[model samples]
Target: MKINFTHKLKILHPFFYVVALCFLSTKAEEDNTDLRFATQPTHQTAVLGSTVVLPCRVIPRDGTVQWTRDGFGLGTIRRLDGFDRYSMIGSNEEGDFSLKISPVTLEDDSEYQCQVSSKKGPKLRSRVARLTVFVPPESPSISPSPEVSATAGVNVTIKCESIGGRPAPELSLRFL
Candidate 1:
């Protein structure tokens, strides 16, 4: 028995359509590979009352970039609410989404990450970057304030202490 040519064509039409769609979908996914982070924020240290920037950049430069502190969202491409010192720097056209904090404070110390949300693929997150805020210690005090007199060849003990410094301050003594 011979099948009609039109009937054969009709039956294969849907199969060809499905295969073409699958190929196109795969190509679309491959095109999205360009959407990636070009620069990831790195660990940094900032002194109190100073400014700092956490750098982040995307390759394709198409998407919304946001800053997160300790895993919580700060805002999307703008200054975060209730945080006067926090703001976004760098141009969005250039894919720079660096987070800037002016007059850094002790409370600004935390783990930060840059996040990108695009229509091409799943959300992208940069490696975690830690910010350390250094606080200067107060004036150091030494024991035997006025004077310490000792006989020749005699040993004396003196103590030095500094208060209110983060990460603890190192102490060194010099004899006059």
Candidate 2:
């Protein structure tokens, strides 16, 4: 027995339509689900001893929440109103998992991870926020190019130095 195209389609159209509908609806619903907070440090540059707020917000629903520095706990006690060099501000439910650091030092320079726990599972979400302590270099002096004139092929020495700070400072040079 041979079934023509129109006849076969007539028999299978309803089932095929139902399956397509289910697949489309499920895909759309899955796309609507909240995205889990992926740890991505937004802080790129910071001066030593300056206050900085690092955000660790979570988009997906979660239960327990905690902030950690290099896997170290930041305390569960709510202390948003309290004034301190380092403080955990904002709420977990609100998805604002940010850590406030004040008067940051060289020791504070490290990666921090924000983790949220739930009945489903404990998700170790991490964000690496770096604290850079910048100390200005010492006053630079320019030796009057001897005769005040040097050929392009001639060699000239320019020196810049910074003699202070807990970590030896970094130096950069630019020829005008």
Candidate 3:
């Protein structure tokens, strides 16, 4: 027994259509590219009342860049909520997507992300960077010294301590 050519074509019509569709969909280079994060944001440390910039760069340089703080809502970084301390620091001309936090305070310490999305291609993203803001210790409270009275020849002892300081702390002693 033999099969007709027309009957064979009818059976394979769906298979041919699928192959053609896949080829057409993947034929455009404008839809996707080698765009990716060239440099990921790294951990940064800043002293209180200072500024810090998190570095980020994309390869293609055509994608739009954005930054998001961890505590804020995940939708977008636009909602200031009376705290617009963060802002973008780079432009398309420089091909940088860094985030700048000025006058760094204890509240500015958090995690941040750099996201890049292609205008005519796919989306790319970078790893998160942590900002650590260091604040100086406040004045200490000395007990018993203010209430006790000492004579000119008598020796007096006092207690002093500084807490909440970072990166090797130091304390000074003075006699009045």
Candidate 4:
């Protein structure tokens, strides 16, 4: 048995063409959705009653951009709901919309999302920013009086007081 050269070429031509078409289609789809977002201070951590900035940067501007809190619609950081302690710190045409939170509290720690959209449906980009509010350890205080007197090798109690915080302080016994 023998195979015809012309018949073999015809069989392979269609398969090769189909592969090329698929590659082009995928590339086009990716190009259309190139807008993306990123953040600075990737991990947002701050103390209560302190201000924090949530920076947002994007690539290629084609439409308006908006800020959100954990996926909820936040027209602007300054005007966001449940944002009494938050505000807009900075915004520019260069895709920089940073959120500012003033007098932050422990209740404000949560996941946040920033969304960017264009007139064309193909240009919708979003980025997530995680906020962590930590209450700094309070200034240690000495109880039962600020100073304690003890004899050599004698048991003495030096108590330190703290409030509005967590993680009980580790009492270290040291003689000075």
Most TM-score-accurate candidate: 1
| Root-mean-square deviation of Cα positions for candidate 1 versus the true structure, in angstroms | 3.7
Q: Write the per-residue lDDT of candidate 2 for residues 110-149, one digit (tens) a residue.
A: 7766677654554546656665556554654445532345
lDDT of 1 by residue, 1-176 (tens): 99999999999999999999999999987766668888899999998999999999888887678899999998884767877899888887888888999999999899999998876788899999999999999989988873667778999888889998887999998766
Q: Against the true structure, candidate 1 has what lDDT? A: 0.88
Instruction: Please report the TM-score between candidate 4 and the true structure.
Output: 0.65
For candidate 3, the per-residue lDDT at 70 reads 81
- Per-candidate Cα lDDT values, in order, are 0.88, 0.65, 0.73, 0.67
Number of the candidate with higher TM-score, 1 or 4: 1
Candidate 2 worst ten-residue window by lDDT: 140-149
Instruction: Compose the digit string of candidate 4's lDDT tens values, residues 46-144.
Output: 777888887767665556666666667767434566666665555566667667777787766877766666655554545566888777677777867
Off by over 4 Å in 3: 1-28, 71-83, 120-122, 138-158, 163-176
Candidate 3, residue 125: the lDDT equals 64
The list of candidate 1 runs beyond 4 A from truth reads 1-33, 146-149, 153-155
Stretches of model 4 off by over 4 angstroms after superposition: 1-33, 38-41, 76-84, 122-127, 166-171
Clashing pairs in 4: 49-103
- Greater lDDT among 1 and 2 belongs to 1
**C-alpha lDDT of candidate 3 relative to the true structure:** 0.73
**TM-score, every prediction:** 0.80, 0.55, 0.62, 0.65
Candidate that would win on lDDT: 1
